[model samples]
Target: MPATFSTLAEFRTLLTHAPKIDAIALGEAQDRNGQLTKPPGALGRLEDLAIWYAGWRGTARPSIDAPQVIIFAGNHGVTAQGVSAFPAEVTEQMVMNFQHGGAAINQLSKAAGASLDVHALSLDVPTQDFTQTSAMDEAGVVDALVAGWNAVAPHTDLLVVGEMGIGNTTSAAAIAHALFGGQAEDWVGRGTGVDDAGLANKARVVREAVALHAGGDGLDTLMRLGGRELAAMAGAIAKARSLRIPVILDGFICTAAAACLAQTQPDALDHTVAGHASAEAAHRALLAQLDKQPLLALNMRLGEGSGGALAINILKSAVACHSGMATFAEAGVSDA
Candidate 1:
């Protein structure tokens, strides 16, 4: 299936037909696990992961090959309010670093045997400081989303989506607060290690933005409070779901994309795996709301798909144990 969507409504409709995990294959994967040349449940989460991947791929023995990372980098006007610990310029600088193969994600991608991609989108224009008004109008949001969906549609492989906008955690928190109805302090955290004054200001800014458009719902809320890269990620995740491709969501900013999609279409969450638990205070609440359990708890807060890159190994191990290991019957081991 081609990943082509010119409108947000079109993308939303695709979710209606998103392929569901194969139940029969899922059961067989678990059964095969029990028959492997090892004690029952000896591999813990790895065993469970094999079953999950099997269901997603509709294969009892799943494979993880040629994983790819798509990183969307944008700029936020709200950084002017001192909501972030770093300047907004860092977004563009890090994007250049990614292009030069020097960022953390570049190294992690090489180590994980995955390709790295980065999109440096329009950073400055039309992104209003949310403390004043909506981030982008409906059309602008849709355009960003279309770009993201188009990027993912052609690739048929395991996917991980990441973000690179400075002050994006601020955008994510604001979006979360609006969708989930939480206090600003509860949803906002120190993005990129803000100081005491910075954290309070970020929370305050988020509260102001949430209050500004408290009545908006669905994509309206997202367009009003979301960042460009976030809108793109939401579209990518939705497209991946529509195609039955497994997605490993990165840390805070990335999960915010998942949360954004979940706000409109809850089923999209089924095609995803939480890569890790982030240090962001709001992430746990968001994950709980989505009913997602992350594979790692490294306390990592790096946003450049760092956690997701590391998680590829664990997913590979699940496939390895499922396909590479011989059955007890094949190994001539006596039944216990």
Candidate 2:
């Protein structure tokens, strides 16, 4: 596909018209849930999630089909500051963990029965030997993301985007400030559990990074501070919407990338489901702008798509209710 959007408004309109919850399918799902062996409303949110999934896919019997998880790993220049307890080298190590199938996301994905693809995006770090993929520039990010979308386009019914980059929260805050035009302090937060002094340092780093790339456009901001993984995530979102595939976003970093994508193409939000609200205050602001209510709020700040894996179970429950339950007419139950 061509990597062009005449205007942000045009992109937004394209996303808005993307796949939506199917009211008819949702109604059918609720009816089926009522027909389940359990009492009505007994299944709680599980049933609700199933109905929502059915509606979102516009199918009375929606399935995850080829469930795939894309984990984008990169390094951040802002990590040079003491924002995180871990060093930038850990990003490479964790990418190895992902390749070796030992990370939390790997285990959770296995438990959830979802396939995984790890993309080693080049940002500020040297390319390593763990599944070496091309580094993404502004245009490269868009193209790589679109290619990823096309790779899984035909098989998957849903998409989950996860990221791993040390000091990514710093990059996220900078992007958030640029896209939303907020103070760096307003977008900055304690990433990886930084204490008072550490947070202050992180805030300072963010302010400097934002100042470094004062202006240009969204793509410029992304290239200057945003990791290649985040850029690819933004592109993946656009491609996903173009394919009408639903995506579940992870944490602050992923949400920030989504925000960048949304700024470029507002309608992308239409196909996205906020997995959870991060403890990061900036995440709250980002979700508010998207007008998305998260599925969970366990104060989780892990950036390996753990939240997305957790949310997948809820989505599965929704699918089960919609596909397995019976309707009132089939169950001989009274409408009244």
Candidate 3:
């Protein structure tokens, strides 16, 4: 289905209304964790992650099932500025690759026993160059976001969002600069392994775009600079939170979307997790803004949701440890 939005303000209201996680479940989950067979805190962050899910799902013993990775595919007109190593058509090619099960995310998701879906957005049109004008106006953004939100609505247990857009890092950096008030050089990264020349061009393009939209509000900044995929992910994250689902973000571009949602609603990241730390320089700063510690550090810069696919096993492990293990009483083991 195509995306639709009544207005920018109305869409913002939908995003901000995603319900907060239930804290009462947190206490019960923690108490159950303390009574588990393992010593207190022995499992460390795994225990913490399990409890975090418990609060979101409102389940004392949260279990992960039917984990799905949805990759949003779009093309950025900003590539005309030489921001990425690949050309714009590669976005369409990669989307085709995903459909044919020839991409890294396909292999990773299969190995993890998770489902993978790809949404091809703007197959015929790239977002207009934001350095000149808005990549997508409020109406366009609403359509993209609604598509993403519906793509994610089917799965309630675990959702991982990845992107397949060329030049998206530049768009993400522009959003970071607007929302975080940072210089473009600090936010731009060597997307797709750009060389020295391409890196300078990427930074320059981002800086120019950020300047174009300076002093604009958050939604305005996003509409001006952020592309369709990022808008979709932000909407999906917010909507998933409303459904009490946990979202694992893929890499820098995906995290940038999460950062947008968090900037809009501070508690938005409460139900989110960083799949891994990207090799992208700006990703660390973006994660810091959301206060999310990644579950992996594979030094990956690929953006096809590969990192998120890898991290799905870790989340499943947390679920297994939380639900499968027996308590001291059930195991007939007494504490000394």
Candidate 4:
């Protein structure tokens, strides 16, 4: 059977109207945790993160079975303006590195025992002998993203979205400004080690790109400056939410794609967990605007889902405690 795509409006409403956390189950999980022969609250946020996961999945035995990370790679048009420190060819190079298990994400994913899927939605400069597909348009973005979701939907219990694009940070900042009504100065930041002058130039380029794409639809802005991978990631988020799957989001560029998805479908945030606090200033502002709390703050600037993969370990530990720790009753200990 062919897959069906959910509209942004419908997704927004469904997420908004989704049921609240199950208080009884949450309380039970908390009580069980307290009676597990350990100091109360000793686990810190892991306890809370675990209980939240319990409520999120509505099961005390909530497990992160089949955890998978999807890293979307593409090329941004803003690279033409020299805003980024790295050359645009870096996008294709990094995509290859990801496929070959040489990137940070590869190491992190292996450590966390999560599967990795790399998508090359668009490569401005294609590399010979690389296994990647073409850049996708708006509809193509929807189809490709939805197809990926359908392929993994039945087996995966958790999903993480990451991005790899040379000038994508600029493109993401531009999208943040255009859709969220922030100034170019408010949304722009140093991407890949741009100096002070380079940062100013990056901001100016973003401002210009925002001006050029102003007063048009969201999808148009995506097609103009946004990479194909970002657009595909946005669609992936929507499809995951429609399937009631929880999504973990990466740094600034991924969050920018997510912001675009949220603008189109506000409820998408309901199923999302911000994975890290990026060093990029724009990332801080975007997280503030979205009202999200990241799971980690490691001054990480590298993208490719490395931060998200690191955060997954915490999530895994949380689920382990929730599912495997014994209650006082199970341990034959009296509760005081």
Which candidate ranks first by lDDT, i.e. highest?
3
Best by TM-score: 3
Q: Looking at candidate 2, what is the lDDT of residue 62?
A: 74
Candidate 3 clashes: the total is 0
Stretch of 10 with least lDDT, candidate 2: 126-135
RMSD of 4: 4.8
Listed in order, each prediction's TM-score against the native is: 0.94, 0.81, 0.96, 0.84
- For candidate 1, write residues 1-336 as lDDT tens digits: 445665667767776667888899888898888899999988888888778888878888778777888899888888888887778888888888999998889998898888888987796563789899889887788888876776684555578889898889999998888888868998898889999899999989999999998874457777888888998888788777766678899987788777877777767788788989988888888888888899998988888888988888888888889888999899999869
Clashing pairs in 4: none
Local accuracy of candidate 2 as per-residue lDDT tens digits, 1-336: 554454334444555565655678778766666666666777777776676666667776777756678888877555545677788888888999999998899998888888888887664453221112222344544444544444444466677888888778877887888778777789988887788888888777777666666775555556566776776687677667666567788888888888876665455576788889988888989898888889889888888888877777767766766676666677776655
All models, RMSD in angstroms: 1.7, 5.0, 1.7, 4.8
How well is each residue in 185-253 modelled by candidate 4, as lDDT tens digits? 888888788898988887887777667666654555554556666776776766566555677888988
Question: Model 4 segments beyond 4 Å from truth?
Answer: 6-35, 124-137, 140-153, 215-225
* Global lDDT of each candidate: 0.83, 0.71, 0.84, 0.72
Candidate 3: the clashing residue pairs are: none
Model 3 spans > 4 angstroms off:
1-5
Clashes of each: 1, 3, 0, 0
| Shift in Å, residue 332, candidate 1 | 1.4
C-alpha RMSD between model 1 and the true structure: 1.7
Error of 4 at 202 (Å): 1.4
The candidate with the higher lDDT, 1 or 2, is: 1
